[model samples]
Target: MLVNPHICPAETTVILHICPVEMLVNPPTALAEMSVSPLICPVKTSVSRLIALAEMSVTRHIWPVETLATRWSTVTPVQQRRSSTLAPVQQRRRSTLAPVQQRRRSTLAPVQQRHRSTFSPVQQRRRSALAPVHQRPCSTLAPVQQRC
Candidate 1:
């Protein structure tokens, strides 16, 4: 447990029995208060010393935030390089696809118009076939089941 001497000077010597993992996961809200004051960790009271003690408590647990920050820093350059390499390829694909998409749209327009004109009769026929089944009395099922 990280105890800021400035915040709780009397209990500064008192060691907290909380697990570092628990502390990290649900960090004491007081840490935010301690962090608010930049001058809280002056030469007389060392924040590094408190942090070192906290680090010792959680020696087994990896400091995820720090680790991830470092990892992100390393990864950012690679990501930037990859994105830079991909930009031209993406632009080229977009350029090539634009004409193809326009051509497809033009072809599909007449087909869609033809389909709309021809589809009504087929749709009506289907609806008419289903209409009789839907309109049939439920009592007819018994006779059909008996025959089956």
Candidate 2:
């Protein structure tokens, strides 16, 4: 194969080979190849162009169409049913928890106020700094000594 000296230096050579059918199908692959590697590697322009074109043709047209039908069909009815049913159970659990959550909220406000008044400001700051965000620290910071 004659390597275009302007494109590929004499010291190294690169070759690409492609069938005629691939050239007709995708042209961008060939363009990409010319842009990407011809300067760095010593490849014949025609061959790289053809190879790139062929790759593009396969990627652009052939593979996706071949996959489109099969990929979607692979999801079984059982899996679909499971996913649909699973979503609502999570929603229902949240709805069910709402009333119990409201009850807890009503009871907790007065108790939290009682706690604030009972502890001094320094102790309140110390307790808050040590406490987990979700749970209050009892004045003594011990579960056994905890007040309601």
Candidate whose TM-score is highest: 1
State each model's C-alpha RMSD to the native: 18.6, 19.6
Model 1: lowest-lDDT 10 consecutive positions: 12-21
TM-score against native, each model: 0.30, 0.29
Whole-model lDDT, candidate 2?
0.71
Per-residue alpha-carbon lDDT of candidate 2 for residues 23-104, written as tens digits (9 for 90 to 100): 5567678667767786656567777998999999988897786556345646667656766777799899999999999999
Instruction: Residues 1-148, candidate 1: write the lDDT tens digits.
Output: 2445566644533544434445677676556756756556574368777788888878646676446644463657756676678779989999999999999999999999999989999999999999998787777777766476
Q: Rate residue 88 of model 1 by lDDT.
A: 94
Per-residue lDDT, model 2, residue 121, is 85
Native-to-model Cα distance after best TM-score fit, residue 37 in candidate 1, in Å: 54
